[model samples]
Target: MTFAEITTKRGDASDGMATGPLGRAHVRADGPAKITGRATYALEHAVADALHCVIVQSTIGAGRVVSIDKSDAEASPGVHLVLDAGNSLPLVPKADFFGNLPPGDTFVPFATEIRHNGELVAAVVADTVEQARAAADRLHITYEEAPVVATFADPRAGDGNPVEAMSKTWGEAEQALAEAPVSIEVRYETPREYNVPIEPHGLIAHWEADDRLTIHEPSQWIDGMANQFATWFGIPFENVRVVSPYIGGGFGSKGQALPHSAVAATAARMLGRPVKLAVTRPQTFTAHGGRPATWQTLKIGASEDGRIVAIDHRGANETAAAANFVETLGVVTSMMYAVPNFRSRQTIVPVNTVVPGAFRAPGKNPSAFALESAMDELAIALGMDPVELRRRNEPDVDPENGKPWSSRRLLACYDAGAAAFGWSKRNPEPRSMRNGRQLVGWGMAVGTHPVYSSPGEAMVRVLANGRVEVLSSAIDMGTGTYTILAQTAADALGVPVERVEVKLGDSRLPRAPVAGGSQLANLMVGAVHKTALAAREDLIALGLSDPNSPLQNQANTLIIEDGMIGPPRGPAIPLGDLLTATGRDALEVTRDTLPEKERTAEERLSMFTSLAGMERGPGIPKSRHSFCAHFVEVLVDEDFGTVRVSRVVSAVDAGRLYNPKLADSQFKGGIIMGIGMALLEEGITDPRNGRILNANLADYLIATNADIPAIETISVGEPDYDATPLGGKAVGEVAIVGMAAAIANAVHHAAGKRIRDLPITMEKLL
Candidate 1:
């Protein structure tokens, strides 16, 4: 069904949800508080008797900590204590990039050795944040520097034991390349970029006299932090109460309990005082996981008419020697499209850099650029329409799934996006459309986010007064998760939106998964839907059996509409009637949706994972994720070496869209970020010094408000219901998939030059 042609609308006035008689709810929950700026984010927290904990970072990329003299800083006013890594005992170790979970010894931050340029070398606590910052600058450090492998220029030279660092194998790629009808071989590089979430990283720890530590920080996952802190700090999980009531944003960096967060808490526990540490903007790019620098080589062999035969995708990402974190980009190259004779490989090249972590689409953000750009070029080479080319190769089943898609809407996406963007009217000639001095171009792309689910627990409480309160640990990251969850609760309880209150983002609340990977909705809403249903059923039974209320013996069927639980047969009666008759304030119910993996295991080991989601610690059935079709329109001023993304139309089919407005935001954000990855954003690290330079918002360019043209988002929502109870999929991460390439293809259409390297920098065009 078409996205905008609202057919089934079932919402109420209390929440501005649903359509027609009733549809989805309105933007409830945090809308007014957020728009008015009265809400408190994690960074704005105030803790009594808290000392400012300032982090001192490394100056060099790779080196041994030769000497650390802190006498000068220790003597400063307001200075309470200083902590190097040496002070943090029970050094919790984790798995390196290649999966060889390693252990540490004497990691005395500037005590013995330095690893990456931004590595946390030391921390200081003082009366004020400024004082801590000032005293931290007084630290004297001397290091024994070593040669830094900062790039993927030489794979083997940069990565030790290439065999184990990057596992790779495939068919006879060399032989196929020789006999191809038409072959395109290109190397694409996407520079490391920072996720400049509006809220800077900060932590405030409150260590109670009772040995229980309460931390107020900005994290997407409080339970995950509870677990991480407990594991790393060598403390009982119960003692660590992570409270992140609100967060500005977490692209992907806030998924885990950050290293500095751990260090700050450990220092507070050891020093016997509360500690507050906040990273500077420059420090943010270094300490937190930045998008790793990528160097990819994609080889596509196609027939004379532009049909791809063999696809070989090989790439390596620059990561930290201290922490090996690899965001594999070759997955799409292997799975996307219908090229079966394909193989992929990923190599993690250890560079003198901070550990890289998940950032939005991960590899698909870049790989889609590479693969889609090639497909665009292939279309141009064969004089065929790019949309038709993609349509020709659209696979019926998840080649990886070995099963048909519950429903695939790539064709629908292509058609819908094309119609919206006016793809049919564009001229196929270079610099064909012109308005005055501007050489106008239009571009479109396909967006596809995979399915991601983590374990989550939700508590649905029907108050004694017939009110609904959903206690959840999930955080809303610029997405309308709060409203959507409330909708599910309302729909399930058969109550009005006013009666349902969703209390989320608190550790005290039941554990919910981190709000990322487009998994927040999938993980949190199902349990709520089920729980609400149960509550409604229970209330109905109570009314039937009690016979003390108007709802009893009415000889009518009643469904919860708005907040009334009256009869379909009699005069409408609000659910509040039961509470009044019973002389109660509210009723409550709570249930937990186990991670799909474990819950599915409880069922027969069917071909698909259980409709329920799963938590970490392995054994989850990693199914073949969802897919989409992207088309972009770009206007390239060829002579000026400049491009403007005039329009972007993205079509995605991410299972069932519980709320269209919410889903549209995901698609828009994805395409917009993709445009940045293609044209503007990149984190530049110095090759000579192994230091990341563009570490702040000013130097690193993301899409400004003006940079984004009209983004037309189309969703083939829930055409596929293979692995999800709601017939849903992960839509956030893959929304920008193939976004850049669509622009690149449009660039070719307007400028007739294929600029392989990023940004299509002016120099390259000139």
Candidate 2:
């Protein structure tokens, strides 16, 4: 399917060609509002007669509630109502994975069953947040505790159904491993991690009538939330509206409509007043989704020359018993390198914990940590440079399915990043390079993420005043979606970006896919491109039909530039003049853009069949993925076991960059998060009670400004037209996928101790 070609020649001198908005650096459009504190988040939404709600949670991870006594709480001053399971409205049951509802049990306030620690058991609504918190603390609750498995190592964790794709084999990996000249078997583990977005989960729900509801939420998927709310309340989908114009961050946590949203909405309808509920930071640890802890065993066999012959990866991840969301840990192993005999498995261990969901890069993050580290270990055993080892195994096509990459410049990324990070000067011997008391070590790793795009709709309108407006329901999540959309519209419509206004984050706008999986920019921008083309064509048609127009019948000769419509050699007239002559206030067009159905169908079939451990067919089909490479320099204190990242250089091949500034920001953000994952961040749980031990910011460690060092991001190659009209793939997730592996590899080079577990803490090194 060919789209309207919108080209930006590198050195064009036309008045409309102002350096082309693509591949340029620009300040974020929302920067002023954000810095000045004028931006309103979900919890900041104000409504008349809005009440505050505080949820009361269960102390036990698994249990049945005996009784809830709310007498003192209900009688407290300023308390409006105390609601429990017996009094609160019943909600529809949650569906399977990727459902509209959150990935957990349905919201049953004060329910008999407590599925996990910190499960909401009741709620108190009052005149203010303080009063609600005060009253909620006064409620008395009792529970009948039940035995629970809190970790993947527990024998009972294997009671759930085995994930079908957890175990698969393409050839006789065992025999190949035994015959190989060199082999290594290693184990790696990563602790559970939380998606601690700066803004906690919050919702402000208002019911205009019994059937009409409006909710302000920090939701990454407003459409999904609207659908879930409508279904739960038995109302028309159109009657439920979600507004989330600004979100501090999501990182995959706020994408679903959690139980709290329904509880708040139900309370608002019952009281005939708006209710605002914001989960405290502590509640976010257990209430919202997180990355599950994983344990992996990797067995790799290589020839004497460092060519891998057989690869085996087996892993298990913790998950809530109610959720079937298995992290795709083994999926990356099949695509990373060229190996004839390969086997991979990912087991889902049911543990008493919060349901695990997609944290940025999800499966690929932990998988890369295991696979890439193993590659380094194999490189060491084979006495070869790590980079050369990877180069030797680089597949001309996808190893698993024999598919040609739409665009894979992973090799180029390594080349560019290695040169920038001075990888040539590194010593192969461990603990050899040092800077005084700190051991200096350099490491590199390759990163990749599947290119994902979904159908999306967008509306474009050219007003009588010659201003253009692009509308969609996509979210920003601080990733600069608004800025990029404006750039796309400005470039497509031949207007200054300042004159093009982009509106988003409302369910009433054109439909858009969820703003996760790094797909929102490509999907929404493609829709806008199509919409702008339709609107431009409509303007030309209007000018040709207008009697007052000079080129009334020369539609083919017309050129639209800088809001002016005219023939290339004739007098030009403002677009407003043409609209005025046509007696129209605005020309509007809406378009829905979908991925190529045949290609999508083929890819889906291949993915599912491969997951089922079936044999792949012959021939090299088209494959799509974003690639990246990270070169990290870490300074490890030989005596104290303190590891500090000194420098990082990342080269990415994500196709065309709409805004280099925003892209660099995203790269840096991902790298910072990766540093946290490798050195400091871990969700600690109390084994005795299955409760999060350190849920607050003060206790839980993330990479702060003081922890970050110099980070350099380089964009590689031209835009890939085969991937999307914008010629871009996802950059949001890939940067972090291989980061931890790189850092861990550097630690091995510095300390000679190969710690396979994450957060490479001092205790382990000591």
Candidate 3:
């Protein structure tokens, strides 16, 4: 209910314009709480008489549980209960956040059959977490092993099923490629990557009654998961309450209800005691999904002048047999350039592994790696500068659907990024530029992600004490969502940010869409604006109707500025005074809003089935997308095969800057993740048994402080009115798109070796 003190820098407002703290950089309202350890994350919520639950996992990759001997664990001291497939309560299968049956729903926990390794076999509840873990270890389990198809490369795992929805061909790509003067054909592969958030996945389930359930879990989509949980327990949706005030990080992993949560809730109801379950860091690998492994074969044909002629891309990603959550790689490939002939086919390879979920950029990230790397190869085939090649193929309209862009400044991004990164000083010849014994190289790639806004709701209340409260269910995944939403509400209500209190991450708050795909800002901002506007109007009406009001009978030109309501060029009365005179304690308004335009049936279906945003719909003549260009510098050791990212300069065109400081952090964070993708991070799975070898942080390498270098982010664009009322696009995912490709291209320029596969490792280079 409380936020840290907000720091704001205010400027003088004009007579008609209210220059509140909307675009200015303000300190985060939750900074003090987080730094001082006052912010409560999911597992940190303590409940009285709460028993700890530990899940026993199946050892075999793919198998059927023959028998589970839980008598020893049940008899252990401090053990409350030991529940397995034999004694588990029946739960309903519910749809996931995207309206599809995820593995958590399709494959019930404690079931006899196991789809993959680490499948939940039993749940042990005890007085303490240590006791639960000890009891879980005492349980003996036997499994009948089955042949496992671990990955797409396995011959047993046949060619994956074609994702018919993602397959598309506009022109004769084969014929165009055959006749083109310059063509390049290559294959790229991105390995599985895990989301290693600072805080692991955890949940506290307290069942007040058989019909009533309350869950305290970290979530990105509170409303979506609350409904899913209600369905699972066969309880009234209104009876289920989900509270998540803060999340360390989600990155799409916490967007839906996992099987572990359901098991904990069931345990709580059976024991008549609250249950707390925290997935260990090692268990997180198989407990939730991660970025799936993908293989893409790309063929690009270009003219002598460096214009792209044709693009043929066939992509496939690994998925769990129980869940058909495939990455649609064609979305980014079809629209990136102005190719006359373009063809794409996406497939999902069902393997005995954990179900794949959305990563930061999801399908778009690997797709960008394939497409942009191919573009760089195409540039090499035509002997053209990569930047110039992209410029030559820049499209006036979207090649996939023939729609104009809301605002595309890709060329401008390239210019700005190149200038900032000193692109002009680079030598064109491979391995020609060097610093001492190390080779120096410069590389660049274009980045783009669709702008999306879902239907959202917000409640705004203006109290007579000159205080404002903005309430929503949308959660911030360390993306500055709280700060940005507060700024938006304060700007619209003509109040200082310090007086505004923002409440979020609770299912009981006004409904909101999932805070993924970088869509929350546009979604909640509009809702907050509308609700604030309504409240402002109510205050103005109260002032105009009051007989003693100084602004009586001035409804025609009444305006609110600096917490004051009056005529545009005249003296104003304080909003608190109007409320005091009217004997009203507060003015409250709740607004449920849709996107700027109505979504088409197709768009709505896409939203439910896929994480993709609106592509073509009514009242949307333009294709709304954010664009950026990343210029990277790299140094390669000739003998040790070590690659280091020296510096990076990324210029972005994500429309108006809401919070420059936050945006810069987002951009640099993504670049650091890109650095990891290029040289460090990889999820190693044993193909023999489908077991993740590097599940723990000690083995799973990510970019550390020593790995990161100087990164500069420059914003370049005006307000895009066609996108949203706030005039801003998605910045979260766009910064990471095409980033890996930029680094790979730089490696090729430095070492004269085109390592097409991802994570340009030392052995691969050697």
Candidate 4:
């Protein structure tokens, strides 16, 4: 029922609060409810008198609507509204390029487009989903099909103009690479990656009036949706409400605006009713955008002393017909390693494919695979340990700019991670480490993600009954935002966790940055901190004004803690006593926090432009990168060619491990995703036609009940307090970064083949 309601007791609360009471730490804030299957997800919601809507997607990859034969659907019992390309109204117009879709890797949807497959060509709103689906099948539509380009293999095919552009750059390119002493070059590519958040994108919309719309959807953003809907529909920001109590997962899929949300809202408006539209599992691929595949060529040169001399990385990939979105694959080389002569370019071509968007790490995973793979190759060429080679070439400042890091311990991370992972225990020779039928190789890679956090506001109301409700617009996309916010409020208000009631996922409460860039804690902490302080001041003021209460004269000399206010050296009386004495209700406070604007402004002005939009570690004296060394043990049957990851040890440093249990779980999830990416994950395309072959789950295999290994993740870092209030960088992306490489390296060690490509298919070994 609640964290306090859990009956299992381990010990006492002396060890500074963890999971359950005392030393028990919940793997996640909402772990109990999730495991018990009591948590409510979007599609599980049941609103009063809500109608159902189902989308009918186009089978062809590219096409234009010729005719909509919807008579059969309209005539069906309980069928209400049918939306197709002809009658649809976009939340954002076709001409205006602005709409919230999460920052970076920009793409538009429903803008004079039939860009990709599974698009919502038509949708029928009916009394029930089953009725809607049945009715939809009866209606027929004609299409004038256009030739599709679903794969990146062809460079010459696209819609409108050929789209290509590098997001950012630096240094003289052709001149330096031609002059290097030793050089190496290779090509790297990665296929499409879906977030595969168990909760498919969907929305329930209730339009009480044309001006008032309430939405219950699975989202990582509540305030984001509020602002977006407010701006898009020209309605007052306060009129639109969003609610999400629990989210199965987001990864990147559930961030912001989608066409289905608009569809549900439109359905509610068309009929004076509430409408629910949850995408079918398979429809998520075409209706929602995902990480597109990428191809990169890296040419690196180094001196005899293990110093990097030059690097040239050029890349290209396909985006959707609606918009060209390119992942900056070469951004890391300019900043990750110390290289003077480095130049890179990223070109994105608009294909008749689904628009590429954010996956877990977005551009970083594929980029790291190529960059780290080449680094390992360089280590082999130099006859040096890969760990030592990276250590030897560390930068004194962020290479992208000459600026300092806010806080950096990459060297410490490498040294500590290597030692912990037992890097010295393994043989450097690829085929040396062996256990009867399996070869084991250990590999390490460095990953750096920005420590980004924005501003947030929180409202704290102390009720007459001594209960406190802290309201925030921050939501938990299965990352424990709810518990963390409650914890922060409890600690601040000097109340027990049970007494602190947290209200989240409501835009009517307060504004917060979308839960992307790993900034939830950073964005929320400031508001919670200030609001708590204000509540304390209010309590103190109340005590001073009244003379009858024990705290009246003592307010100036007293401190408040655990709902008590009294002298620092003596027993403090409960706040409820003071309220009882005065016959008053309770204290209330609200505060809005803007991130130290000066800090954001300064970073913007001082950041390196040559590295293309990526922030150089500003304010630190050394090059900043988060590091992790993965140790994977694999069991491969010589006959089957299927290598199973038996065990994995990942040592990482993203700064502090906030909730060790939660942090560990995050790493474990990363390891599993990494295993899938390394061994089984790939979106296959048919060679005959550009259609995606394994678009469904049954065709594309993933790590499931049987494949997960016993993963042990050890985090190393004293904490980077200067980075943020909680002292953590983006921990979510880095684990998956070098993860695929480590698993690949292990596979190579086992099979004696260097398979550089991902989803290292068994055919390569067979």
RMSD of each: 4.8, 4.9, 3.2, 4.7
User: What's the lDDT for residue 382 in model 4?
Assistant: 82
Q: Give me the overall lDDT of model 2.
A: 0.82
Candidate 1 lDDT trough over 10 residues, lowest sum = 1-10
Which of the predicted structures, 2 or 3, would earn the higher TM-score when compared with the native?
3
lDDT of each: 0.69, 0.82, 0.84, 0.69
lDDT by residue for model 4 (428-491), tens: 7776777777666666666656666566778887766767778877788777666656666766
In model 3, the clashing pairs are none
Model 2, stretches more than 4 Å misplaced?
Answer: 1-19, 94-110, 159-161, 548-551, 595-621
Model 3 lowest lDDT segment of ten: 9-18
Off by over 4 Å in 1: 1-25, 89-102, 105-111, 154-156, 159-175, 546-559, 566-573, 580-585, 595-626
Tell me the tens digit of each residue's lDDT in model 2 across 1-766: 0011122233332223136664556677776677778889988887989999988878998988899999999999899889888898876665423533443445553446877788888999999999999999999998999987778867867745566765777888999999999999999999989889999997999999899999999878777677778877888777988999889989989777887887899889889999999999999887766899988899999999998999988888887865666887877788999899999877788788877888998898899999999999999999999999998998888777777887888889889999999999999999999999999888888888877766677898888887788888788889988888887777777776777888888888877767777878887778888888788888787777767665698646677887788987788888777887777888889877643434464343222111111112232246778888899999999889999999999999887777777888888999999999999999888776788889999888999999899999988845777676778888788899889999999998999988899989988987
Q: Which ten residues in a row have the lowest lDDT in candidate 2?
A: 608-617
- Which is the winner by lDDT between candidate 2 and candidate 4? 2
| Count of backbone collisions in candidate 4 | 7
Model 3 residue 202 distance off true place after TM-score fit, in angstroms? 0.8
Give the higher-lDDT candidate: 1 or 2: 2
Q: In model 4, which runs have C-alpha deviations exceeding 4 angstroms? A: 1-27, 89-113, 158-176, 595-626, 687-690
